[model samples]
Target: MTTTNLSGLVAATYTPLNDEGDLNLRAIPSMVDHLLAQGIEGLYVCGSTGEGMSLTSDERRAVAEAYVQATAKRIPVIVQVGHNSVREASQLAKHAQAIGADVISATCPSYFKVSDVATLVQTMGEVASGAPELPFYYYHIPSLTGSAIDMGEFLLQAGDRIPNLVGLKYTDTKLFDFQHCLELQDGRFDVVWGCDEMLLGALATGARAGIGSTYNIAAPLYRRIIDAFATSNVEEARRWQSKSIELIRTIGKFPFHPAMKAILEMRGLKVGGCRLPQGRLSKADAASLRNELEVIGFDVEQAGGLAPAE
Candidate 1:
């Protein structure tokens, strides 16, 4: 896969669904437009925020295709195709490439632990082989995956084998290791940070791009942080970053996925509730969240409405 580095805020999108948890294909267009209006740099579809693991492979494919079609190449779409079964991930990657996805990413198989670096590399290689023309990114979120392998070392060992191995979605909070990964091969990789609240810290450590679930609804706030940092306004950047952290904390009071969906609904897009195993927000809770958001200055009209980061 040929690769390019992406910068600024990339929103890890939610998979829109109906009340019955079925795919809501019609929601994609408006969702795309909304994100664009919010100044998101790109979309990371079928990842954790999108409930990739909860959806069937067929559903994931449909969601991926829908997002790609809706985006219409306005911004790059990075589809997460990781699965416990290597073959399934490869199949998904093939579909992503076939549908014109800009990039492909995969998390480590968490069900049956991948024992060592070589094995992990071999597994990811199989998935990349299926789509040789697209840039491949490893999604390293150890909290959920529990693999906890040294990411910097993983890159050193696997970077050469996976010909199109461009970089990773580094979600762990290990700054030392993260800095080491960025320094690898004289900083050849595109190591986008994944922690939303700590983005300022990541930027200080040299992260050029970041992907986060909150960016879907809070991109404008973060754009201020990025801009403030660019202009060396540490105090202003800190203020926005603190506000983002507070918003996340407030939203955490409710069931995570449902509350996030509700926030979007409150913002004028009724993309609907999450699937089974993930609960839904009540009208009362949605109203309360809106009130809290307003208190925190989550302007629906201006949410993520800043100019795109240069």
Candidate 2:
């Protein structure tokens, strides 16, 4: 979203569920500590990567509150309270603010299939109006929403009407569209590349932050990559980015949530397992992932290791 908190690396957290498919509020404090210890710049909770689409309204809000309390002001937590309903989004945003979240973001309403520019703008405006004081970002992933909003008008209107319109967690695969977003909103919005594949290209064009599912496993490496690049260590950054992408490709091979959880368990975090619908990673898949992880310098022991770059 807009404001000083929007810039830098914000990991879209994976919602950790308990065995009964309930929200795992207790696991958050250690998770937040893990991320903070790795130098993660920010966090986006209850978003797509966090399994927001699958959680009930109360479960999602509870997770948001847990995250806010767990983070304990160590870093910014951007709560994603988007839903298919406007009232739901408004209520969740209010919840996010009440829980002390640094920012609140929402995606365009999905399943309606209304692709017209007018309709898209109206939907975002309604959500923004609901949380008038909070900094908001358009969760622009055409892949999930089943409908696409025009960034040109959205960005333009966001600039004018929504004073707290901070940025977009861009998920549209096309760099041209992403670039157009940066160009149109140039100085006005801070773009956070939601997709892992586009991080380098996004960084090239001045994307201020990255909000990705993969960052849960690779935050330290990302921290290294971003720091290297910012300090003009272009070559080192290239090395880190290449390694990062290689690791991402491995995680991408499986359903992302379980794969991430598997990695955590392998590391001995005792983070527990993914609930059904998302399900557990198959045994074969886990082994293959284990191998892939080892290749990228991640080992069973290294998973929860404190070596920093080990």
Candidate 3:
């Protein structure tokens, strides 16, 4: 596997949909353009933000293809192929490699929790082997996967077992575990931070990159956090991070993903609301969300560095 690791803000992108909740593949190009304009360094398609688990296998592949094609190599597209089935996840991985995706990531099967590090490693190995040509990142999201196995142990054992295994997309709030994984094997793994609000803490713990949902709406703000931190301006970095927390909290007041899609719609992207269970934001809720965001001084136009639409 290539030794290159993801750096900067990688957006765990949204799966654009129509009002009917069908894949609006046509919207992907503009969505990608918006992200690039926002200074997103990479794209993580079909992750939690993208509602990957909620989609069918075919739908997932189509979404992955649309993102890869839209990106057109301007930046790396990391496809998250995690599924409830290991075999299906592997098939998706193979498809991702076939379509020339830069990297592949997968969460362990969640319906039946992976019992230990060995099972987790084996499960991931089977998935990663499907795309042996690409680097593999095991998505460590304990809250969603219900498998809170120690990542340090998993990585240590997986290093030799899975030849293509590279790093993790750590989404938990555990700073010490994250730090240990980052420093393990003398930083052998590319541990991209996944908690948006805790990014400042991750940076303090030596995170070089972050992948998250909030980055889709506010990459410029997070970029400022990174820049300030790199320049040793801790106070400024904390200020930006606090703003991020405010934004996230405001959105969290409603159905988080649907509210995020609504924010994107306000910004002029036709990204419809999320799929079932997560559901859509009501008209009233959307209006209230807009008001809340305004009260917080969130400039939808300037949120991602986009110029106001004339």
Candidate 4:
């Protein structure tokens, strides 16, 4: 099998919107610069961080297209096409393919739920069929989808059926299943880790690529963690990873996406706040979060300088 390796930091990017909650397509250029400046390898757009489920299909397509065009093929852009409806997911997948996204990923249908691994395979198979030529990854984020089908079992059965099945965006805490999926078929698939706080642990267990929300602001720190590990500086890696945990713990105090967008704004990105259902941080709260992040050693200016050498 010819495997694809999407290693290093693949940021699950936030969809930039204006204060009015409309798509801010112009922000894509700067967003791309911010990510590239940190030496981030690629982007996972319209995923959980991008609030894929919250937007309309047309909105998702516009967001995906902006990212793709802004990137101009500089790096891989994996567009999350998952929806509660398989047909909708397939349509998004086909749209992603048409827009030149590097890969397409989908989570399980949460409302109806996949009754079993076979059903999940069928569900995902339909979505993947839309973009038959593109690599497909199952976004196994059971926390949000609430469909905790064993990934190992899913892969075992689905691997043969989905011709474009490449791997999974392993987001659940099931390290055992993650390892099983990683080692399965002699590492045939790319199992990109998702949980930011447990990233070091996942790296220890053979996770090469990682996708997360925090990567949008903290890519340089995580890149250092990866670099430290590469040089066998385990202690140094642990220190950097610890900072990541602290950052998440602090930001998670508010609504996660809103808090994150606040941080980006504080850093001068102006990516705007989260839409309703995700409330915005007040001026006081935003100020406090900024102080907390600064105390944690996040230097907005220096982040770009910390990117790994090419």
Indicate which candidate wins on lDDT: 3
Cα lDDT of all candidates, in order?
A: 0.88, 0.76, 0.92, 0.86
Instruction: Return whichever of 2 and 3 wins on lDDT.
Output: 3
RMSD of each: 2.7, 2.8, 2.8, 2.8
- Residues 176-245 of candidate 1: C-alpha lDDT, one tens digit per residue: 7888899899998889999999999998999899999999888888989999999999988988888888
True-vs-predicted CA distance for residue 160, candidate 1, Å? 1.5
Residue pairs in candidate 3 whose N, alpha carbon or C atoms collide under 3 angstroms? none
Q: How far out, in Å, is residue 175 in model 4?
A: 1.6
lDDT of 4: 0.86
lDDT preference between candidates 1 and 3, better one: 3
TM-score for each of the candidates:
0.96, 0.91, 0.97, 0.95
**TM-score of candidate 2 against the unseen true structure:** 0.91
Query: Per-residue CA lDDT of candidate 2, range 120-148, in tens?
Result: 66777777776677788888888878876
Q: Residue by residue across 1-310, what tens digits does model 4's lDDT show?
A: 2336798999999888888988888988888998898788999988889988888999999999999999998999999999988999999999999988889999888898676898899999999999998999999988888888888889989889999999999998878788999999998878989999988889899999899888888887898889898899989888888888877898888888999888788767868887778867899998888777667666654552232222
Q: Residue 306 deviation, candidate 3, in Å?
A: 12
Model 1, poorest ten-residue lDDT window? 301-310
RMSD of 2: 2.8
